[model samples]
Target: MGAYISTFPTGFAGLIPTALQKLLPGAQVVQVYDGLVHYRYGGKPGDLGKVFLFHNTFLVLREFQGPASQMDSMVRSAAGIKSLPPSRGSFRVRYSVKNQFVAVPKERTRQLEGKIAALTHAKVDRVSPDTEYWFLQRSEGVGFFCRLLGRRQATERDLHPGELRPELAYLMASLAKLGRDSVVLDPFAGYGAIPKQVLGYFPYAMVLVSDLDRDRAVDLRASLGGKRGVSVAQRDALTLEGIPGATVDAIITDPPWGYYEEIEDIQVFYRGMFASFRRVLKPRGQVVLLSARKREAEAAAQEMGFPLRQRYDTLVNGKKAAVYLLEVGPAL
Candidate 1:
């Protein structure tokens, strides 16, 4: 087995352990911090790329806790570091201090490069190395020496304003707890992030995505309509245009947060949204959504009789937000 570390969005750390366990049946969660999770797995380390919540995954070469002065010695003496596996060509080192990405000091970078060269006879390539290592230093003097496992490849789609990250999109989709035959919907499908995640990771019979903007709807159809069992439409989510009542299994979306557009009264807007949610969702169906307008969302859901099942406070693009799981109740 090998020790591995994964970084996720803050406040959703608790979800990582379960996600890893589901991905790898024999995985054991060693620790869970604010935005990081450490686990041990017997399977191929590269397979960890399947985890959607993880922004990055690394193989832990060493873990230590002591004064900052001991970091160099800790790296040199670490048993895991002594096994100098063959590298493609060159290597480079990076640093993360107190959860913030920072440039490695020239002296420290050179020192680490020299140590690696002495151990493995490899040269240093700072710009584009075949292998990269990250040394993360925590606030309490804890340190983790990690080797990057998989790099995120760029996609063809350009990110739009206020777009939800794919990692967070998968997180919200997982909250829905849908079945293989369930039909899912994204009412406000801006670029279809949530619907795309649901289709990619979760089991669902069909996916319905709609947006109020005609241009975005065309884009969604062009990008997503070719897929099997995907339905794209240009319609106001508050009214849910042609969808019948009590049909959808779950509604997962990132509604307007009164930022790009003006929402005179968020509560009133949510009430209208919930009215459609009540009509379209099957009995006991669920609604999992992300919103920065917490008070208004919870208040409106409660007022509309959708009992809150669970809520995860997290950050989206450095902005405070929360994911709420609400279930249809008697009031609905």
Candidate 2:
């Protein structure tokens, strides 16, 4: 059976299996090695699982762990030989190790490689092998598993100040139901974390990134670079009158919550955001919002003629955070 491999965030590995089910319907989840899950299926899947070739696998390992010591060890293991040339039919091992823990031992790898070679009578070269014997190491533990092809690395970028974490970005992207062509707009695009993440998955889609502070907007633009087709603007998110009407597909943002300033008019700001969102987003388009004030956000959406579609519980710095998905009202 044609097989493939996938990787996900450390604690969020559970989401990968769910995503794979959606991407490759009826595909058997033959093996799950810690963070890497192996699937036996036919055709290639979509971007939901960062699919990768041999070269891409090498790049991902180098980027994630640097130097690829684990990969080298796997090459010398006897099991490596049994998985010769790394094809879909070959058996391979995949796992994750703690980033700070003891580095993988070369002797252990050599013994594994020798065993595989003896069993299969094949030479092992882990670097360019097609069989994806992958390793993932986080702060907690190591995971090992294998499949026919290695998947791509999860999205990685320089996070902006006051931006949500990478894990949150992944969750937001998935929760937003973003398609390959879905246009994403981030009004309070502080440092452009959400937009950058959206672009990472949907590079060709339109992204409207805006922030009130001009300097922050400039920084966001610089971080985003000029390569991706992104449009940057400096404007007040609360009053999005400057933005064109009926121009957005989905609104996904982490708006400012009154924490330090204890602003008296917090409700007004939320109402404005809701009104602007209703004005710009398409009828079927939705808004996925991350907010500290769940009740306030829900109330604003209701007042603005929007309906709450879904809500997800998230954590920020060990504190409770809520993610809301809303759809525009019929009158809008």
Q: Given candidate 1, what's the lDDT at residue 108?
A: 59
Best by TM-score: 1
User: What value of lDDT does candidate 1 attain over all alpha carbons?
Assistant: 0.83
Q: Which candidate should be chosen as best, given lDDT against the real structure?
A: 1
- TM-score between model 1 and native: 0.85
lDDT of each: 0.83, 0.61
lDDT of 2 by residue, 158-276 (tens): 44346676556656766777766767788888867678667765433677888888898898778774746578878887677567778788898988877744567777778888887
Each candidate structure's TM-score, on Cα atoms with residue i matched to residue i, is 0.85, 0.57
User: Model 2: residues >4 Å from true position, as ranges?
Assistant: 1-15, 18-161
